[model samples]
Target: MASLSSLLPAPTQQVWDRDDERKAKRVGSALVVSQTSVPPYGQRKGWVPRAEEDFGDGGAFPEIHVAQYPLGMGARGKESTSNALAIIYSKLTDLLPSEVLAEDDPTLQKPDDEDIQDITEKTKLALEKLTNAKISAAMPVKAAPKAVS
Candidate 1:
């Protein structure tokens, strides 16, 4: 199989775990809550979390890779290529489980359809709250007026 880098140049490869450099590393934010941040300016700014730095122990967290698509003719170019790589990284990272569990654990298997629906509904509600908080956090701060000289 062709690597994501094969699709473009200067691909940004992030590792949630550094155990192996040859394979992809899944970055799970749930693993490292305290280290996460949203900085201004940059590919991941505004809620972008760092790979290994933001994720927790490798033994527990799962990893995924997400890449972004380009917007113009240069979409296939270097910068766009990097952007695509980042998109892929994000997608992959997002799919990872919050924590790894034993295979023998029955809880690891998918639940019944009704359970699934219930889980989905709960997830949606949780996401709604999280989104609201995130939007509130992203709001710009107002500046105080200066006195005339």
Candidate 2:
């Protein structure tokens, strides 16, 4: 019988220093983001009100998944977030009637679709400025200082 480690596609690359100061600072930053982005997402910055109602808004659900990781904070934060989200998606998939999951907990699926040629951005910075993305922001311009002659 093969060991559990053998099941993973590849061992996680240890590109980060576990005791780095930046990592600790970023963890705090992540927690701050999580506190805002979860539960009441209505008041988040730039969050536009939608016509349709959202799920779990009644506070019926006890808890929801939020990013708070001891490892993989700043530099690789997106990767960690993506990985955690994928796992949650897998569980949701498993619950669906039509979906077929090989492994219940972590179903290994291709991050990219085989048929499409879409490029997946691993980092948030690249995604923030993706070619087809449209974003706009403008601060109020103070009226040109009153001209006194």
lDDT of 2 by residue, 15-102 (tens): 6776797878877774444222333644444443221132224322223344222232343426444464453544876777795567
In model 2, the runs with Cα more than 4 Å from the true position are 1-106, 112-135, 139-149
Q: Please report, in order, the local distance difference test score of every candidate based on alpha carbons.
A: 0.53, 0.45
Tell me model 1's lDDT, rounded to 2 decimals: 0.53
**Residue 126 error, candidate 1, Å:** 1.2
Best by TM-score: 1
Q: Who wins the lDDT comparison?
A: 1
Task: Report how far off residue 123 is in candidate 2 (Å).
Answer: 9.2
Model 1 lDDT tens row, 1-97: 9988788876378645556543433353255555453343344423423354433332211222433222232334444434644535347667786
Model 1 residue 22 lDDT score: 30
